[model samples]
Target: MADIQIRKYRDDDAEAVKEVFTLGMSEHIPSSFMHLLKQPPTQMVFMCVFCALLASSKSILLPILAVTLLLAGARQLVSYMFNSYIDTSLKKDLNYITETYLEQKNSCFWVAESDGRVVGTVACLPSENLPECLELKRLSVRRSHRGTGLGKALSQTVADFTRDRGYAAVVLYTSVVQTDAQKLYEHMGYYKIREFVIPELAAKILNFTLIEYRLNVQGD
Candidate 1:
């Protein structure tokens, strides 16, 4: 779409901003669940053992029922953890967008508008976890708007902000599942410097890791 405007978020854009972020994040749940299921310790081991029990035993009803319960439990556990993450994150940070991302001299939230609607979002602020660097957060683009250069535009916006302010670097974290995001970061000259295992059960079961990427900035 033409006229893709990247500007600071306004008061009226709160609802749209929340919607894009929520929906964008929710899109990963299905893939995450599927990944968890394939892990040998989660569903695969149980299923295999249940199958063996059924084949060898004459009275299989009770054993098969137990297997069914076990499988259901594993599935529910993943669901609960993912939903809890969404809830806690929204309450801890998303609800205070203005304060967390928009109020400080070094912090800003930006939305991408095309045809008078916000289809993408991004934010950056001084890193609390890292010194002398800015942290990029919540970079999301609606599905229909992907590959239209909005992602690059949003990223460059944060990099420009960091460079202008003479921050030593700009850093971000993305899940290992987000291949597209990794590609974009690398294309933009960001490189993976570290990786940390996610603390959630579902994430650990699936071997999910969070990759940290950084772009060193120089003053002009």
Candidate 2:
């Protein structure tokens, strides 16, 4: 965390910021894919096949697990449906970070830089879901920088902005795959206000729940 500086977004930072974001988010695909594989549908298929062949030997369990892991790991990187959103956001938002985030009256973006390289990012903008509250958006800390308190630093930037601007509260949304993010938000005094599962077939099978958290800026 040496020489870490959190400051206003700069025009030249778009590429580095996008790189950090893309890489940071890509790290979740492995865990998320594994989560998907552990769902009822995938599990039932794998277990049914394994059970059908159990007569072959008691030593098949390790090989079955290894194969399952390999397939899921491959899908994590090659499944366009599972990862297009992250790539889309990078192409669309990073290209217009200023116009999308920095131009709004009550919105701003901050990047955490260490040793002259951007390592994390966070942004706050007026929430469309709640007009009185600010939405904390795109809080990303590089994988190498986790456990170093970079996440709290980035989140605090948004909280500080909300308080300074007299916003009623701060709100954020994270998916079920991001369990660590849920912990971080809760640790910062955010409370889960809503949860809903995606209606898509695959998501329904995986039980992909979208969670919304809110923190009162004016009180504890």
Candidate 3:
């Protein structure tokens, strides 16, 4: 509820922006691991492994230990997936915020600063897959700053930027594990456009899905 300032991204804010994004993305690992656990394939594999070990070794302790190890491995996989994504993002547009968003035509990035510290970030650029529509990306707020409307304000920053540029709509992709984001976007008038499984082998095997949402600002 403090006075939060939303302004154009600056070069000096690079480290803060990356930190916000990394922390935000890291927060989802637990949920993603749970998602993996809920997958039928994962459940079946765990059950089979546990039962086979129990029958062969005839020791409940060994089977329990094996199952525990498998669970730890699954959690590690989830962490790896999230970490890889964070690393890729840092090496991509985030690595060149000025060039990718600030200097590019019809593209921009903004950071939300509270009490002189960068606490949130959001960016928009012309969508590659949807002509005349801007894609909202890199929306993140520091964990300590959540529940204070920072996320909603960052989202509005992207929407206002898109509308001012005469874009038809704003489109974004959020993974299934990001339930709070799905709610936030829907609450802000973004409608679900479609959902599709990520094409990567690990994602495909785990049934990971990304939901696309669009907010029509043409007539608003």
TM-score of each: 0.87, 0.84, 0.97
Q: For each candidate in the order shown, give its overall lDDT on alpha carbons.
A: 0.85, 0.83, 0.92
Off by over 4 Å in 2: 49-79, 200-202
Tens digits of lDDT, candidate 1, 182-209:
9999999998999998886666766777
Q: Tell me the lDDT of candidate 3.
A: 0.92
lDDT of 2 at 55: 51
In terms of lDDT, which candidate is strongest? Answer: 3
RMSD of 2: 3.6
Worst 10 contiguous positions by lDDT, candidate 1: 35-44
Deviation in Å, model 1, residue 218 alpha carbon? 1.5
Local error of candidate 3 at residue 51 (angstroms): 1.0
Model 2's lDDT to the true fold? 0.83
Q: Compared with the true structure, what per-residue lDDT tens digits does model 3 show for residues 52-159?
A: 999999999998999999999998888878888888898888889999998899999999998889999999999998988999999998888889998999999899
- For model 3, give the RMSD to the true fold: 1.1
Could you tell me which 10 consecutive residues in candidate 3 have the lowest summed lDDT?
199-208
**1 or 2, which is superior by lDDT?**
1
